[model samples]
Target: MAATLRDVTTYDLKLAAPLAAGFVLFFVTPLVILLALSFQTDPQGGHYGLTQYVNFLGDSFSLGVLGSTLWLGVKVTVLTLLLGYPVAWLHQRSPGWARGLIMLLVLLPLLTSVVVRTFAWVVILGRQGIVNATLSWIGLIDTPLKLLYTEGGVVVALAQVQMPLMVLPIITALSRIDPNFADASSVLGAGHWRTFRKVILPLSLPGIVAGCLLTYAAAITAFITQSLIGGGQMLFMPMYIYQQASTLQNWPFAAAISIVFLVSVLVVVSIFNALGRLSRGYANA
Candidate 1:
């Protein structure tokens, strides 16, 4: 009779039980409570129904807030991708020392507190800020352009804060690709841009999707960045939810908006997952 051996991974899987239990205790518990709260017809918890969700869905202004929040995420993600991809590509092509330096610079933003970074942007975008001062010195403008407390300002600040999320994954993806593929393309008479578009880009789409998903989620729900950069006059979903819950003491409606925003984000994430799957197939093909 032959002796049977046990699977090693079975023992390894047991090591993660603590983490799984902790996630259930901390994350799932609060989420379940929030979901329960959202169904209440009033903040007092006297009744339970979909009144809050109905009120939010039926209102035009509420819908606009959600729409604008999603659009803002799109702008920030696009801007970060456009700016970060070049940096990642450069890092991939650089010497080892240069690559290390580039990675350090990319990660430096994450080391600092986000509030500190947002405040730095506030200073930079002020009327007497670096941007205006430089432009004035260059004789480009007679007066300072309005930069602070605007959508443009919020997008710029969020992009800078979130740049690492966009860059790091692309770096990982690019590093995995075989360098010989590029050489083969070149040997086949493909120019640099053509080789990149045909070979490098398809291989990198999974990374791009991951980066976009992360950046989009962060940008949309960034309460501090939105509040500081956009100010009170402009409203996003995060702030709208805050006002309803904190200011007005309307927990049911606030919870409802939170659920709507959460579902909207999940839908966006699912679309990204689909894109990621398609990109993986294209890359494999």
Candidate 2:
């Protein structure tokens, strides 16, 4: 028995070693480099202190950019949740062939390169795009409305891109819920709406939280969609970091901005996790 237990422990360690090494090499090492660089001086040879962070925090323009980035993340997350929940619920209750079709539609965007997807949106939302042509033909306006290079355009593109990530998790949670619960509630004289609100929603909180966390994190870190859709007008944190790092060649300041953005994402994730816990506790109570 002792020999068998020792062998099991050795097997577990062997299985874990490669993953641990990869995590340290790929994720932890880059993060450590970024943190160290954040504390260093920029290319102009200022003293190595908190000068980068101080300058970033003190600048009103930087503050506005941060606010816009964060607000965009929130808007994208909320929009995805609102649209994704019903789609996921319907997919969960769908027949086998219908389920396959829905899943295919959801995952189709993921199969394409992000650059390609953003370009497609550019074509569809551009001034001479299908939408504008249709509106003009129907006499909605004398001229095309400006859709590209705007916040609304960015939000629309991102929500469509990230909707699958939101939907899959909700579908998973809904699938795990037994249909008998709803039936039992109906037999107990509860209406469908009440049963859904009191029973289905509480049970699905875990998936909602998981989906929101993923969607919000992705939206915050997004660059391609924001750049393409907003056409350099929307200055999100990732875009700002890219400009600082690549265009200005200020690696240290860029690193500082990245660290701040990382902290903000972590804080948002923590809040979502806390809300999930509270929801579960209330449901169980």
Candidate 3:
């Protein structure tokens, strides 16, 4: 037994070796470098201090950018959840062929490049694009409403782009739910809605929480979509970081912002996880 256990442990270590090495090499090393850079002086050489952090936290413009970025993340997460849950439930309940088709449609966006998808939104939301033309033709409006270069456009594009991520987790959670629970609830005089509310919804909390975290993270870090759709009118943290690093050549400040962005994501995700745990505890109780 001891020999077998030792062999199993060895096998597990071997299995994890490549992944561990890759993580340290690609993720941890770069992050350590970024953290170090965040503390250093810029190329012009002022002083190695908290000047960047102070400037970022103290500036009203920076604060506004951070607030808007966080707000956009929340909006995108909520919108994705609202749209994804129904689609996931339907997909899970679908027949094999229909399920396959739905899954294909859901995953199709992931297969396409994000730049391509954002550009597609650009075309769709543009004044001369399909939405405006259709609306104008239908007499909904005489002039093209401003969709491009707006938060609405960003949210719409992001929700569509991240829908698959939200739906996939939800479908996984829904699939894991036993049909027997619903049947038992029905036998106990519960309707479909009640059964879903008491049984299915609680059970699916894990997936919903996971999807929210993923969607929020993606939305917050989104650069290309914000850049293209927002047209410099809207500001997000990632775009700010890019502008500082690329255009302004302020690497230290950019790194500082990046660190803040990382910390903010971690903090928000932690809060969400805690909320999910509390909800689960309440449900279980």
Query: Which candidate number has the best lDDT?
Result: 1
- Distance from true location, Cα of 250 in model 2, Å: 0.8
- Candidate 2 residue 3 Cα shift, in angstroms, is 8.3
- Which residue pairs does candidate 3 place in steric collision? none
lDDT of 1 by residue, 1-285 (tens): 587887765667677999999999999998999999999999889799989999999999999999999999999999999999999999999999999999999999999999999999999999999999999999999999999999999999999999999999999999999999999999999999999999999999989999999999999999999999999999999999999999999998999999999999999999999999999999999
Q: Which stretches of candidate 1 lie above 4 Å from their native place? A: 9-12
lDDT of 2 by residue, 75-149 (tens): 999999999999998898899999999999999999998889889989988899878889999999789989989
Candidate 2's C-alpha lDDT? 0.89
For model 3, the superposed segments whose C-alpha errors exceed 4 Å read: 1-11, 279-285
TM-score of each: 0.98, 0.93, 0.93
Best by TM-score: 1
Tally clashing residue pairs in candidate 2.
0
Supply the TM-score for candidate 3: 0.93
Report lDDT per candidate: 0.95, 0.89, 0.90
* Residue-pair clash count for candidate 3: 0
